[model samples]
Target: MEQHSPSIRAQAVALMRQGVPNRVVAERLNIPRGTIGWWRSEDRKACGETYEQPTDCPRCTTRDFDESAYAYLLGLYLGDGHIISKRKQHHLSISCNAPQIGLVAAAEDAMRKVMPLPSVSQRHRSGCTEVKSYTRHWTCLFPQHAPGKKHERRIALEPWQQEIVDTHPWEFIRGLIHSDGCRITNWTTRMVAGERKRYEYPRYFFTNKSDDIRKLFTDTLDKVGVGWTTLARGSDPFNISVARKASVALMDTHVGPKH
Candidate 1:
């Protein structure tokens, strides 16, 4: 590192003590930003000050953000995402199938769009990739996060969140499908005239163990004029099926299969 004169260091520290940001002080003094940051850290330590990283969280800062992205993220969270807000560990994690690299990129993009200040990373595990954003303020944006598993607890959206979902229902549905839903086709052979004809039925299915989440999904489908039905898997009514021709077409046009 290039050395700076004591006088220059003193001036930088003085400006920083007066609440001028490190970037401003660095530019004003023509010092490297990293050196300015070091000086500020040293000054704070000498004065017994604790440093707090700056954040651009939408809920905490009350700043306008990409609501379309946020609506999609909300669906992802409610479907299969989770937040860890422990004192030493804080982050939001969205798991994506390892083969679906597009969904991984989309998840990371949504996180950055909502809160760009925090760092984001992807961790590969088994057959999935976990996209994570490090920041405790995630709780502020995802107030629905709480103790216990999501399915074991009640999940409801805030009014503001509902408004965003109402505005961008398709994006929200896409997020949900990307996280916990899939597109499937069931085909059968039938006798037509004198020959066997193959008939294929394409449908979309969203499976989540949470009743409230399934309700939210169905409610959004209703808002978007898509018909859905609940199918019981043995005994658990945890599948939302969109098999109607019109509904399937609408889903294909908007959500489609996870890529």
Candidate 2:
């Protein structure tokens, strides 16, 4: 019989630590299934933590979670993030356009703050960077997740979730606006005293197809004492405009453009 190398055994241990089952690790690494279990037991004895499927919810087990980070992540998920559930596994995927690298980095940072254990990975696709994590408690944290497009469904936050958002409204709005909104300078020319003068002003715009989600965004802004206007009635894609100097300044203070 042939023996496996130390590196192969170490790889097997690493995979098991990432929540991969013993049978799957054995098959992937071509190690004996019996030895995989023995190795896990030995590793647990040495480390005091087992590589086993969590019996309780990760959110419940986490005692030192940052509520502000979680709220911001919730806003991001409501704006541009999505969850895919397959069998017993769930994946959270958030994509930022190529130009918004800072927002992408911020999303990854928030994910690390919320769930530090699971590995987060990034991939590039069609001029966008997608950050994803494999975790079971994604739905638990964002109960607004459901099948079908977000606009077609009624989206509401729970009381506890709302409390978190209330405490950190700026961060929540930052995540939401960074994901689906934009800040730009609007310019116009006016003829005054026989001379044409050009003036430029800053404005913020948030567009989404879902009325429920749009309402949620506007409601949050309202709670934060920021006023906004609608483009028109029956707009194909609903638009919320924040053009007042005061409101723009307030948003600029809290949620500036993504770098």
Candidate 3:
């Protein structure tokens, strides 16, 4: 038995391109046929980046953005990386803090303009709405994200159940404020991971807002009945502080304006 040093998949792929049969590929390598096929797929992925990579990066070519591909990406972005049993056939269900229908609409519109043959929804079977659902994947053509380019990911944050965030300027800003509390994207600023998980602050992201703008941001928080705090706890358990103590109190007491 002549042993090979590299991965069996690489060896198998080399053999496959050489016109080897599954049985021969299996027996010659002493590996399973199914494993050979799986390796072939893995090899294909190595050639292309994941769906989350910057779209049209040339190097990161994705499968055509059809219904099936959209379903997988939707699961990656809006769902829990798993498709619901109920919607395996027709529609893909997604959840996120809905952004502006206008923004989403604009994206949809842009996608349509680019591919005029099929409407995005008709061709891709994707529909956007207002609803907030929790998931690990962020929905944007550029999911992993690039700085100054982070806005690319905002479309994924659009929620359907509640009013879409796209229409409200303050809501959008609030989201920016909320997201800013997290870690700095290494693309734009020097990022320092916290000593522990969740010990890291939720970076407070902003798009070049000045001091007066920040004050207006706090004012918006007050007006919207949303409380926020962005202080560091020198030695606190959570290791961070919240500034909008009063708004949180109002929210807790259920004592403010309603949408």
Instruction: Return the top candidate by lDDT.
Output: 1
Candidate 3's displacement at residue 217, Å, is: 2.1
Candidate 2 structure quality by residue, lDDT tens digits, 58-124: 4577466788988788878888899999887788999889777888898999988888866788989
Q: Over 4 Å off in model 3, which ranges?
A: 1-170, 182-213, 225-246, 249-259
Give the least accurate 10-residue stretch of model 2, judged by summed lDDT.
50-59
Q: Which scores higher on lDDT, 1 or 2?
A: 1
Per-prediction TM-score to the true structure, in the order listed: 0.86, 0.81, 0.20
Give the CA lDDT, 0 to 100, for residue 71 in model 1: 86
Q: Candidate 1 — worst ten consecutive residues by lDDT sum?
A: 82-91
- Total backbone collisions for each predicted model: 0, 1, 27
- Candidate scoring better on TM-score of 1 and 3: 1
Give the better candidate number (2 or 3) by lDDT.
2
TM-score preference between candidates 2 and 3, better one? 2
In model 1, what is the error at residue 137, expressed in angstroms? 0.7
Q: Can you write out model 1's per-residue Cα lDDT over 37-96, one digit (the tens) per residue? A: 988889889999898878898877878999999988988888879998778557999989
lDDT of 1: 0.91
